[model samples]
Target: MNGLSLWDHLSVIRDPCQQWKIELKLADILFLTIAAVIGGAEGWEDIEDFGHDHLDWLRQHGDFENGVPVHDTIARVMGMLSATKLQKSFASWMQACYDVTEGEVIAVDGKTLRCSYDKGKRKGAIHMVSAFNAANQVVLGQVKTSEKSNEITVIPELLELLSIRGCLVTIDAMGCQRAIAKKVLDKGADYLLAVKGNQPSLEAAFNDYFRLDMFQQEDANGYSIQEVGHGRKETRLSLVMEDLSILGDLEYEWPALKTLGIVGSIREERSQPVKELDITVRYYISSAQLSPKEMLEATRSHWSIESQLHWRLDVGMREDDCRIRREQAGENMAAIRHMAFNALNSDTSFKAGIKRKQKRASRNTEYLSQVLSGLGLS
Candidate 1:
């Protein structure tokens, strides 16, 4: 039933249960939990229910000698496991399953688990910063922080765990710091970071340069496209300038800085008046010398982390609806969801959206096997 077992990678995570008291094996628990999540299980109870329903199928991959553990046992074991170890395992499994090609865009962004907060403990909701492969639609790795502001710290840690060489790492305005840019360069990759009010001087410089209408110049690379959907028409203009002279020594602060980019979007709803049209302009700094088209594609690809990864976790997986706020259970459960996502998204046999695939997998063990095929289990 398997070739490249995810359990081989998961072996790095130490079981926290005492030897004498252990009823269910760690492999049994992890495999059951992962398979359940892949079948749309939202919480520990769902995971246990899935385990009982699919015990025979699960037994094919794992011993399940003691049968499926109770929901509380699953919760306790998952809570006791180290999140860091699980994350490293996830990263390793991803490397085994997906390869990052040269110039591939990897988007880094953060999402908050809204229901993870525990008022009894006076703890706030946790924010998870994830690195997603835009081209592959897979999650590479993630790091959890207590607050969104800590994403600045968590991002570097997450980057340290990935094989991002020869890739273009993109992030939102929150990741435009000099250290972050240098981290990307040091990792043997390039960065395309958004510039906003956080970096006041840089944002001001971009505003000043763009005001001159120099994007029309012959030396600058430019591209434009129009899209019609969702009852609106959108026109996107992308511009890239390789000349760093405009930065006036500010470029020295950013390591290997080579290009500046701007993407301006004008959208008007079909029912709205022309005067009511909406326009947005975003600025970016990149170490990669990308063309206008590449810049546009890379920037647009950055939002895939939000639209594909984060949105799917919340809606398809029902992550925010679960209130598992004890100890490290929430973080570890999130890791399982990422694993499930990588499996479901990487499966080519299913030609449907994530939710549809989940529903099919829940009803048909054959389709579930197809999903596990990505993890080297058929």
Candidate 2:
């Protein structure tokens, strides 16, 4: 028996082509598009250029017997692909290469593909709800929706596809619903969800319970850290309380609810003629009975999905600047970028920023092969 190839895994993604009209293999096209994107190609024409210049490099992984498809052909095929299937294949590819460890923080969040919106077509920008592993700095999976509000519904669907057992899953207030909480718990994972106006009663209840002089309270558990930078001083105070008895009537409302927590942030300018101070407080709920330090760390780790994944896509991969507006094109292209990101992030042998890695993948075939090897493509 032979092991599966990269195309074998992507073969699960159904091709949207007629039997007789097929001039290019769907796998070959997908292979070219992904390699092109990994090499910093931002648009279909860029993909074509990358393919033309790196045909031999691409041939190292795929068969380009008919030569690279034209940019328009690449665009049309990608546009016509099933966005849902593309996402599934993307997730499957990630799962094939990575796994979340016990207690690893898997942050769930959403990002919008800014330039994907088109006024002429009245099509909204594409939004993606993603599961990111903070420890590994890799995206676990993602689901697409047209609007941020749609994340509430898509989050549970996304969770269903992940192997979240024993992992600590975290999401913002958008995913603070009871059903979402239950789903996370049922998936054999613990959860830390934000509490805000969306759950007005729960928010106010935690407020009333913690009003027992949190800063001076004897039983309150907290962790504090201070930072000074850019002519400014900032301090973060993270507090956690394991008492749920204060919930009173709503005590049993949340599933496996064990801890209620809060984060207080303060910032002050150092060089201002007239000094100013800023303070803000946030509330949270968790199923795990974590200490102040553990709770605080988990909360901070959830933001890695932004700093590591979302920020990289926007700034590093130039995802927000991409103009692939055709229906499903934006989403399918986003999936390719994610595959590129994971591949770049996983190969630690080349220690450099993502931009440098992208450049090397284009300018150096040996380094490109190493990155592709991370994705089981070379």
Candidate 3:
């Protein structure tokens, strides 16, 4: 929060509180700015600790709330802020922080705040869908959903708010819905949907037709094939057709179906090396007319959402261990963690995970200031 420059830039977009009181605006900004700097801050106590520790620097930077609102005041104001309005404003604020590169691969994934579940009350936990730019390693945006609703519903809602015109969206099987595909196309982006049992018939048909047309070269259109293996898994593949004919009588609207393929793979782990296993054939549909190399790149890049983003959150940022579950506190804190993740990743020269980056930031104020400046926060 030492840098008020980013907050000042966000203020220009729209009044943070045309509906709420001005005190609430100050409290919200102060809380979020601090949250961005220090992850895992929840409620008044955490913010108070942050303020107390950073008081001198915050005062020097004009980032401290006037008179340093007490913990109770901070808690009350946070409780009063409308969750919907705050989410919307925060989404807008994040859009201005990073530039979305053209043809960027935006990976969409969901994670539940495990501690948000109240077992005594039998209430469900908070679930959120996050859109991360795989190329830049930045979290573009996140949308919180009701505990009972699946991410399929929330993903589309989050997608509707983004501008991914030329980007290729990579999502897991949970997001492989026709409606979701249409929404992505409607937003002027392409999709690389993972085929799974959720769409049983579609998955079955794709597998069937792909196997039938494997070596026949039925379509005169462009086609290529490649095989790769690393670690413990090896994949043998063929991409044959380039038309909707691959979908064949499925009755799903696939206006963007341009490529079809069969991905066959075998796995042999260190513990089970003797028993080589051949998994079921996997299928995929892409909107982009990509070459074999591009398809492989897109497919491999999709896993970064898991390895780079989610793994970092769980291990590096300790997201799964968070126990804050009051109103929007869980959702808000998750967004702050993502913000920190992006900030740390953007500081590529740091050459370490979030925890180490934070330690470095905490130990070196000048370096931390430089990071904030890079984020347009200073």
Candidate 4:
């Protein structure tokens, strides 16, 4: 078996380990951990177990000459690593694997790592804001909020880390600030932000401009999507306005405010002879001069981050169940989990869910190597 090597840039992150006590190279240990996580190792003990069980296969990737390190040693090593540095390195690696294309929609959203809190240390759970490629289903980058900060501050920092040129950056109401809009524009990207109570004036502007009567016109600028499945029918309508003659003073506050939009949804459930209907409406703001159809697709695409990235992390990976709270251990582990996600998704030969892929990685050495090759770690 041949030892794997990391890309030069990823290998450049400085090791925080004590030189005299170092038995394994930092890159080797980091990659080893990523491989274990992909194979369903949830904690240090699981990782150590994985290493021992697959030491011979692991040797193809690194010098496990002394065998797998103890669980505490693995924890200690990760504890000493800088979360910020690890994120930067991970972001670079993601860019290397996935290329952002022109007009690609990249959704930015935040999720709280629920089980990462330490009561004895009086620490709260960590909130990670991630930038995800909607079309490609790849994580472009992520940033963690500091002890006393919120997503508003971390979001822009995360945006600055990515190759966002010629992309559409979408965010929820929490990121609808003028500063965030300008930041996206400055990065050579367009903004598609949801308008809600957080932006009181903007939401009011959208509400004021879009009265129910306007939707009655035959030439109303809007697009609609319909889905029917299992005794239910769902329809989504997106309405876009190019002339912000209705925006009043609110128009100037947002940068490149070319259009204001609204989306309405109606769902019908069939049980009796008659059907019941449920309807909802939402507002949005965009910097790009897009048509209603374009607006609809971009808006719909934004949810991919939740469905593709966050859902998989919680459901398949059991991210919420993990309790690896110690210094930078939790943060580092989360980043590695993401790496595992990227690696697993890269391989199409394994035609199954993430859980099945992990099970295969555990039992099939050759398949594990193929998965690691996705990160260029094998």
On TM-score, the candidate that comes out on top is: 1
Cα deviation at 129, candidate 3, in Å, is 0.3
Where does model 4 exceed 4 Å of error?
A: 1-6, 146-149, 272-276
lDDT of the structure predicted as candidate 2: 0.85
Q: Write the per-residue lDDT of candidate 3 for residues 1-378, one digit (tens) a residue.
A: 223334553454343344555553563455344543453343457667666666666555554555465676665555444555555555565566655766789989888878778888787888888888888787778888865347888888889767788899988888888899899999899998888899888887776665434434555332334444454545444453465665667644665767664555444554455654565455677787776556666777778988998888888877787776666667766766776676777786778777888777765667666666655554
Candidate 1 wrongly placed segments (more than 4 Å): 1-4, 212-220
Which of 2 and 3 is ahead in TM-score? 2
C-alpha RMSD values across all candidates: 1.9, 2.2, 4.3, 2.6
TM-score of each: 0.95, 0.95, 0.83, 0.95
**Clashes per candidate, residues 3 or more apart or on different chains:** 0, 0, 0, 0
Better of 1 and 3 by lDDT: 1
Global CA lDDT of candidate 1, please?
0.87
Positional deviation of residue 122's Cα in model 1 after best superposition, in angstroms: 1.1
Candidate 1 has a TM-score of 0.95
User: Lowest summed-lDDT stretch of 10 residues in model 1?
Assistant: 211-220
Query: Between prediction 1 and prediction 4, which has the larger TM-score?
Result: 1
Query: Which digits, one per residue and each the tens of the lDDT, describe model 2 over residues 65-184?
Result: 889999999999999999887777666666656666789899999999898888898988889888998998987778899999999999999998788889999999999999999999
Instruction: Output the worst ten-in-a-row residue range by lDDT, candidate 2.
Output: 1-10
